[model samples]
Target: MKAAHAAWRGLEPVHGMIYFVPEARRRYAELGLSGRAGYFTSRSAAFGRASVELVVSTFYNFNPDLVRRALDGAWDVTTPQHVLDARYAAADEALRRAGLHELPALDEVVALTRRAAESACEHAQGRALFAAHAALPWPQEPVLRLWHAQTLLREFRGDGHVACLLSEGVGGLEALILHAATGEVPVDFLKASRAWPEVEWADAQQRLRERGLLDGDSLSADGVALRRHIEDRTDRLALPAYAALGDAGCERLAELASAFGRAVVRAGLLKPG
Candidate 1:
């Protein structure tokens, strides 16, 4: 932000036009840290040396001692040190198996230990996890949809490339054309472009045609203009019924709506685009 503000100093002639860009919001959403009242405190900006070091320190300070005291014996500061060391030695061996030659630092080992303990606790309590995302929050579906839209909007802002935006959010071919509008028109977007099934191909094509989204099989020129216009005019949030909001303090609504839209998508609750 400081660098951006500095760069915009001389452009103050257009500084009035220096509104908050939409892409800024997507990054926060991807990290599960966008909303006002939600986020993990211990990990958020809880710095040590390197980020990996923080995890180790957190394990050494909290979970390691807790585990040893609760199961093995009474714990002093050094009580869990052996467990931490042994755990990391196993990890170092595992990494070695995967062709990663270097050993973990003491801090990294401790951090890895902490993560394993934390994950075990979560697992014991019955929680779903995706590989390493043991602590990712699942916002409401509507909230996730809004966040997903924000992510798309963010990707659309730079060089107008729309692949990531479309690939991540689009459920079918119609949304694909809409995504293509955010950038150069893609020539073969709808023709087996994504991992589409042969079964869904004819139906998707027919739907695109019936919805007036394509010229025969390709997106029409008006479709292109509409995409660009939509990208520039409204956020990809595609928020439902903000009309009730009227124009009364719309700015705050847009900001919240952007965040909410992102949450909706992140929650895997989005309606078809």
Candidate 2:
């Protein structure tokens, strides 16, 4: 797991696997990496190839194996369900790879989507977000995926460190939350994640105050109330659409999404879907 350990330098809950797990004592000897022994149960998708995969959504693609492990983690078992859960997740992953499933096992946060939309409404006083791209050159992830995750342990982290930031934070993070009661500044993923000297937090705070977006150093009462309303409705219905997936099936979704995202990117969609 040296490579895996290196990958998730700043990320959390990193799981990895060695091709063979002949018990906890000799795995490191086989892999030839000297570290604490992170033995693989059948649950270690991070340990096995195809056992692990990417988890994806309309806006993001994640390691599916990661999701599988996450969900499985929700239920603690006294009877050792690791292998059974792994099998189930793998089956689900396989089915998804075949393009049969439409949604993720993870529930959708419609409130986030709606809030993003509302951010547009609040900031759409002059023009659209930007000139719509006539065509964007989409890029597919190489078939040989970067089977790695890392976390960056930096004290004063800043933009300009894409690999470190993503390794530590969300794969795609917009600095100016489209929904937050901040300034009208719209920092795209690139800008939010990459850093902009001009877009400091202090300036954003001032704009939020002057724009009547807040009152007495706080968001307007209406903004607070409306945000909660959206959250409540979305929470009530936000359950995993693919709760029935087996391990293989969930892996399938990750594999399919990886391929599809690449395809969509290559097709040069106006934007990353």
Candidate 3:
């Protein structure tokens, strides 16, 4: 189970960097998607003209208004296939620019990650976003295929995380507040990007404080325990996908994937933390 978490951390940038890289923004601009519209469209293109509500539900954070602004007429400007094509092209370019293609054991890590991703496909019954993405035809290039694999694993875990948050009665804004409390992500970044108003953010924080899960801006002891439980549950939920690899395979994948992820960071493909 620990290996599952470690593997996710290592490979996350493979999929996540696409959101920040200039290659992606350039492609989206060519498609007439301005600002963050490309992000919401490209990621949700697997749904093929998904409703704003559906995206808001599946994304499970981000202001509904923001999502609506980004997605309302996005499909009108471009087809899902076009958006998907651009997304893969951007991912390929970004990964190549990061020199991930030059990394040692590239093929081995792709095979390992794809195996885990395929294993995840078998459990896609209740995971909407993951299932939607899993339905797409696999990319032919090794680098894009690797990015696709990590994207699958990411959505697989994300859908499960949403389930965990739902079960805990945490609303979208509250979830962001909780995540911010951990200090792994900045409060301002989340608030600004998600487009949650300051008043709403404050109200959510007050709600969490009322529930004893927050003490001012940080997690209280009880809050820490709840966060821990949620994360542990999410990790456990993600374990079955990694199980197909066995402990040794998972560890090896993590080792190689982390190196690739680090290369991406060093190449400045991802934002500085």
Candidate 4:
């Protein structure tokens, strides 16, 4: 379980860096998106069958109206499927163009990723978000299939994470605020793309303060502990996907994936925070 979780952790930085990569940003800009709003909406539509409302409710955790606005902007630029296709293509292309494929053991890494993702999806059958995503037709290409599989694994874990958050009485904006307080993600990034109204954001902040989770812009010690608990539970919830791999398999997968992650970092695609 530890190995599987660590393997996922290893691949995560590489997969997630697609959003931060300049090559991806340039591709979105070509489609008329001005900033991160365009990137979020267009790229998120990779789950083409899921509604904008579902996207907002699950992954985004942003204002629905603002999400709608972003989707509208996205449609003005391209169709939903087109947006998804372009995003998949762009991210994949960025990796290849950056010469990541040339790295030693990358083929083995992709194969292991495919294996892990396939196993995770099989276990994810009844999961709401994963089920929704799984209902989509498979992509023809290898790269696209890897991307879709990775997406399913992520959403499956994310749905479980949301369940954990709900059990802890944490809602969407509160979750984001807590994440910010933990200093994991940048505050500006969260505040900018989430599109919460000033009143709503302030209200969330105030509520966190009342709960002893916030001290101005930072997390109180209790807040940090709470956030850590949330993350620990989230990791636990995600372990089942990796548990199928066993310890050695997971360790090998993590070792291979780390190479790709390093390639991503070396490409200057991810910005330091």
Q: Which candidate number has the best lDDT?
A: 3
Best by TM-score: 3
What is the per-residue lDDT of model 1 for residues 46-142, given as tens digits with 9 covering 90 to 100?
1211233333332221222222222221122122233223322332332233222321222332222233233233322211111122233322332
- Put down candidate 3 lDDT per residue, 13-36, tens digits, no spaces: 888998899998999999999988
lDDT of candidate 4 over 87-171, digit per residue (tens): 7777788677556757777657666766666676666643676766666676665555555656666777787888888888889
Instruction: For candidate 3, give the lDDT of residue 201.
Output: 90
Q: Point out the higher-scoring one by lDDT: 1 or 3.
A: 3
Q: Can you give the TM-score per candidate against the true fold?
A: 0.25, 0.21, 0.98, 0.84
lDDT of each: 0.30, 0.28, 0.91, 0.71
Provide the lowest-lDDT 10-residue window in model 1.
10-19
lDDT of 2 by residue, 1-273 (tens): 222112122111111111222232243233332222122232232222222232122112223333444334222321223432333333233323433234342122122222222232332221211111101111122111111110011100111222232443323322233233444433354343223334444465465556444565356765455444443432222112122233343344334334433432333321322
Order candidates by lDDT, high to low. 3, 4, 1, 2
**Which candidate would rank higher by TM-score, 1 or 3?**
3
TM-score of 2: 0.21
Q: Candidates 3 and 4: which is better by TM-score? A: 3
